[model samples]
Target: MKSAVEILSALAEPTRLAAMRLLWDGREHCVCELMRELGASQSRMSRHMSVLRNAGLVVDRRDAQWVRYRIAPDLSAETFALLEAALALSGKPQRVAA
Candidate 1:
């Protein structure tokens, strides 16, 4: 399990932070969706998701050749609140990219 410090540190990267913000809607997003929305290459997006996964902030499942991810549903209330606070403090409106 990742420590709280590790999780917070993961969010410090802009790509990971933006990805988390996109996933904050509490819905599943396919890798392709995230790539297109974030303008990230497949490998780059995968790397960012890996960090988020390691932090326990997100969960993913494979769908044939694709993968889908979402904010982890099993996060403790306290951890969830921390994520909520981080997103709130980001100062960016939550919306899917064009």
Candidate 2:
């Protein structure tokens, strides 16, 4: 498991933190969808996602030309608790229409 600092570092970025909130509802979100919703360019979004992925804060899978993201489901209780607290401080993320 990653240290607390690493995980916190991942979420420290505004873009990555927002992306996590979008995935908080447990829905798989495509990179393009996130890009559109977050107003990020493709390369920029991918880079942010890579940081989250590397920290094990998120996971992804390929779907044709797109990649999907979601919060990592296998987090330890401790990590989840920490994240919950951090997110609580950030307020609610805007909802994306289905």
Query: Candidate 2: worst 10 consecutive residues by lDDT?
Result: 89-98
Error of 2 at 67 (Å): 0.2
Instruction: Please provide, for model 1 over 1-98, each residue's C-alpha lDDT reduced to its tens digit, 9 standing for 90 to 100.
Output: 56678878988898898898888877899999999999999999999999999989999999999999999889877777667777778975654432
Query: How much does each candidate deviate from the true structure in C-alpha RMSD?
Result: 3.5, 3.1
Quantify all predictions' global Cα lDDT against the true fold.
0.86, 0.88
Tell me the deviation in Å of residue 16 in model 1: 0.7
Once model 2 is optimally superposed onto the true structure by TM-score, how far is the C-alpha of residue 85 displaced, in angstroms?
Answer: 1.0
Per-residue error for 97 in candidate 2, Å, reads: 15
Candidate 2 lDDT (Cα, whole model)?
A: 0.88
Backbone clash tally (model 2): 0
**TM-score of each candidate structure, all chains considered together:** 0.88, 0.91
Which portions of model 1 show Cα errors greater than 4 Å? 92-98
Candidate 2: stretches off by over 4 Å: 93-98
Clashes of each: 0, 0
lDDT of 2 by residue, 1-98 (tens): 89999999998999988988888887899999999989999999999999999998888999999999988889888887777777888996443432
